[model samples]
Target: MNQVIRGLSVTTFFYMVTLWASFALFHAIFDKPFDHDWDLSGNFIGLFMVSVPYIAYGLILRHLENRPVRRAVQVSLLTVVCERVSIYWIGSYFAANGYGNPIPLQFIRGEAAPYFSIPYIFIGGIVSVLLCVAAAGVRWRKS
Candidate 1:
């Protein structure tokens, strides 16, 4: 019980930090902030892509040390799916209330926007995985 709570807390914190850093990176490099509107679904999708691996890393740490790799992967994938569902629910809540100063839906045209494109999401995921793996390796070596 305690372990699970600790794992979740650590995972959530890491994921949020990574998300913010990725947003900042995009802002710095692309000279644009992450959009707060759904017409830019690509951006939100990209954020999710970047987030899942970090969440998986936390689950892997909690359950993988003594378990088979296959089992660990399965559990990690499940954790990612659960996190995505929760994110969707939260997004819907915010959208319903016009939170984050979302642009009116009526104003959005159907053209696919470049904000939060797939490539950025993939880059974020790769960077996150590398960072998490490196951190874990360092901790292991220290101990």
Candidate 2:
């Protein structure tokens, strides 16, 4: 129980730090910084970009450590959810912000994840599941 709480805490901390770091990176790179906006908040888009799939993958990995097969099922269901929500998020972000809409199925390199399309979410879930699977597979293999 304590370990689970610790894991979640660590994940959240990592997520937050990542957000801040990304904001910094954006400010450093782009002349027009975005984290300040409300309707088209870079922070908000970034939250979905980094955190949603990150947390989902983390949860899947945690479950995989305890129960591999069950976690796979969980990952599958999560993939579905990620696929839809992520697609919508990307579409809305691009539509409103006029940038960064191309995030396609990233499991395979060079695939285009177009805005307002199913593939955006599909990529989100695919990337998450692939990361979890690869990590868990390596760990389980070592054990």
Candidate 3:
């Protein structure tokens, strides 16, 4: 139980930091460079691409910790959903459960959601995790 809580803390904190860095880079490189339309979907998709290896790294660490390989993979995949949800709504949740008129939710609900095109982030999150696992499996087979 304690280990799970610690693991969740580590994953959440690591992901949040990476997410901020990613958003900063994306904002600077895309949003400000040409001053074109801010493509929030592009940022979200690109971040998922960037996050894959980090997700794999966490899974590998879990493996190193003597958790079963399958369990590590399973939890890592679940963490993808967790990470995405946190990215999307953590600020709003902190503000006041969507009743307090959160500023962050404006970007999240207004910009990101409509920009995503795909109606379900959960599906995308699962697919991203599967891609990471597939890559890891192939690498393990080769080495």
Candidate 4:
């Protein structure tokens, strides 16, 4: 229990820091916020998205400590891609139904419009994979 709490705390801290850093970089480069809506729903979704990479890297680091960097990177990338796809599917459902408070799907569409579009799934997936890989690197160094 103590270990779980510690892991979650560390993961959450890293996730938020990395997410904000990424957002800041994107904002500086594009002159626009990585995400526009700062409401409860939007914040929740952002939390979830950021946590995905941290959790993925944490789990891999926990179970596959002996794995080589190439293999670890591959697994982490796959995990992030899968997670992003699942999130997109859930987002699509919410968008279609007009459900949830303010709806995270709408925020995804509004802020990550280019990335969320049909033609950009691969690009987004690659970017997510890279982000996860980088997060894994940070976790590895910290541990």
Highest lDDT, which number? 3
What's the CA RMSD of model 2 in angstroms?
A: 9.7
Give the whole-model CA lDDT for all candidates, comma-separated: 0.48, 0.46, 0.52, 0.51
**Structural similarity to truth (TM-score) of each candidate:** 0.49, 0.40, 0.55, 0.41
Compare candidates 2 and 4 on TM-score and give the better one. 4
Task: Please identify model 3 stretches exceeding 4 Å from their true place.
Answer: 31-46, 53-56, 81-107, 111-120, 135-143
Enumerate clash totals for all models, in the order shown: 1, 2, 0, 0
Cα RMSD for predicted model 4: 8.4
Tens-digit lDDT string for candidate 1 (23-84): 56666766654454433545654655465545456445644555323333443344445554
Q: Indicate the TM-score of model 2.
A: 0.40
- Model 4 pairs in collision: none
Across 38-98, the per-residue lDDT of candidate 2 in tens digits comes to: 3343334444543454554555565546764345445444544644665555555554554
Candidate 3 lDDT, 1-143, residue by residue in tens: 55546555665666666555665666675665312343564455455544654465555554455543444466556666675666566655644555444666445544443223234365566665565455434434344
**C-alpha root-mean-square deviation, each candidate:** 7.4, 9.7, 5.0, 8.4
Q: What is the lDDT of residue 114 in candidate 4?
A: 21
Report the Cα lDDT for residue 141, model 1. Answer: 30
- Comparing 1 and 2 on TM-score, the stronger one: 1
Candidate 1 Cα deviation (angstroms), residue 65? 2.6
In model 4, the worst 10-residue window by lDDT is: 111-120
When summed lDDT is taken over every stretch of 10 residues in candidate 1, the lowest stretch is: 104-113
Q: Which prediction has more favorable lDDT, 3 or 4? A: 3
